[model samples]
Target chain A: MTGHPHDHGHAHAPAAAEDGPPSEYARLGRAVREILVEKGILSAADVRRAIEAMDARGPHLGARMVARAWHDLAYKARLLADGTAAAAELGIEMGPTILKVVENTAAVHNLIVCTLCSCYPRMVLGIPPDWYKSRPYRSRAVHEPRSVLAEFGTVIPDDVEVRVHDSTADLRYLVLPRRPAGTEGWSEAALASLVTRDSMIGVSLARSAHEPVETA
Target chain B: MSDTPLRRHHDMGGLPAGRVERADHVLAAWEKEVDALLVLLSRQGIIRVDELRRGIEALPPDAYDRLGYYERWIHSITAALVEKGVLTQAEVADRVATIAAREEAER
Candidate 1:
């Protein structure tokens, strides 16, 4: 509910016309935003703050939740039973949308997708990676999940079932990836470090304790 | 396409497509702005999230296919604003023209 100081500076304006005229969609978007700000329906500051809030969210939060669940069987049960409340217990507000935590286990692998659109668990994991929204991903994830996972270098054994969760409703899905072996005594912080965004999204596995950590 | 049971643009799950390439492109500046605008509009109750989704789904198939992730959001937000009578198409066009002219002058 805070207002941002209105700066007339065009610092954040779209790039110069050389990139070809801003697409019609972009032009109209800018126009609508300007009109809203001009009429006092919304302020530049309000928008900036909202953007900042979104920017602050990232996979670290989700990784922490995963690590905590990995260490505490009771907490893992709670997380699986009610993702929304469990996330709130860890100081993450999931907003109005319902978040469902799906676990990856020995016999099954889980993958998340929004067949209808780019519905994501942004509250915990921030904005989705670009590939998650691509037509290839949206289509392929559910159609041929194992192949899609392989593209991300995640190969599932033939004995394991691949479960694809299509986020077609209000429920957003986050994968509670199987905790990698060889880290039985690792601290929660160390364990969380092994959780990458792609792993939470179920496209890749969490890094092992001995493996180097990768960032998105 | 005709054989597929799910023809809706948003119902893209379980269809055949290309390989999943892993490339990380920094979000464009304008895209960040648009994302903020959409979040603000929804937060203020000026538009509902469901309405925004419908707006995106309402885009023509070709346009929907052509637009990038944030570009689709831009189109949806603009359409929602116009549809809600928060802004008229003419006013938007006029404002866009003015902004375009201003950018021209700056260059």
Candidate 2:
């Protein structure tokens, strides 16, 4: 599913030396990784497998969870109660981190951020978008969530109370967006088609029934 | 930005910044490699996420500001490995130089 189109550019391109060599940091990282592999701390094949594992997961798993919650009240209650276990129910490996699902009701909206570091629920969302780690998003998400959301084309009404969750600690949050109107009697899979990564991050809402689902 | 009493380098919630830009989700080849290395290191119990976070936080403010996301990860991962005595700075430097020379020879 498509995420909110927040245009925070990559702040730093991979650094290059004056003579067009790789940046010190990049070279150092490669050197250390190679040394570790040689020392038998890790193997090249292990690195390859890890990359494959991470690449296998994406927002589709989260969409499935949200879709199930939309159709099943019992599942919704469980998801809100224990997001990690709920995600595990669908065979989503959350690793060692905890997943906390926050609900957006008509009266209150929730936004997620990690002021200290980008502590995201990567198991479901995969790697955080570059913008999510940008300085603007990290600072503004908690202070001016409304404006930030507005920048994403998600304008929350003035009457609604905005509750910003700063993920400073272990508990990572996923926003369970309020299911859109006109989605009644739809199958879970069909409803899941409306969920987007941005919506789960609480930066934007799910696509309305009228919007076409954009496949990644 | 300098670290303020209200906001540290890591404390970014509610600070005034700029607009979020839209970009492609493409990862550079080196980035993918580093990403894999990070997961592999963590999975092998060589470093914990908390330890990695601490390493990132320990970076100089200017470096933290200047580095990209995966750059920070690479920096922290390297630091963690060194701090844990898994790899020494001298060895890493030597290896980096060797790799650079090898690449130059190839070119």
Interface RMSD values for all candidates = 2.7, 5.2
List DockQ for all candidates.
0.61, 0.49
Q: What do the candidate models score in CA lDDT, each in turn?
A: 0.83, 0.81
Second chain TM-score, each model: 0.88, 0.87
Compose the digit string of candidate 2's lDDT tens values, residues B20-104: 7855456654566688887877877888989888888888889999997878998889888888899998999898998677556
What C-alpha root-mean-square deviation, in Å, does candidate 2 show against the real structure?
Answer: 6.7
Q: Which residue runs of candidate 1 sit more than 4 Å off their true CA positions? A: A1-23, A214-216, B1-6
Encode model 2's per-residue lDDT on A27-115: one tens digit a residue.
Answer: 76667767887788876677666766777788888999999999999999999999999999999978878999999999988998887
Evaluate candidate 1 and give its CAPRI docking class based on DockQ: medium
In order, how many clashes per candidate? 2, 14
Q: Say which candidate scores most in lDDT.
A: 1
In model 1, the clashing pairs are A4-A45, A116-B10
Tens digits of per-residue lDDT for model 1, B2-101: 7756578666777678898776565544666688887788778988888888888888889889888888887788888888898888998898898777
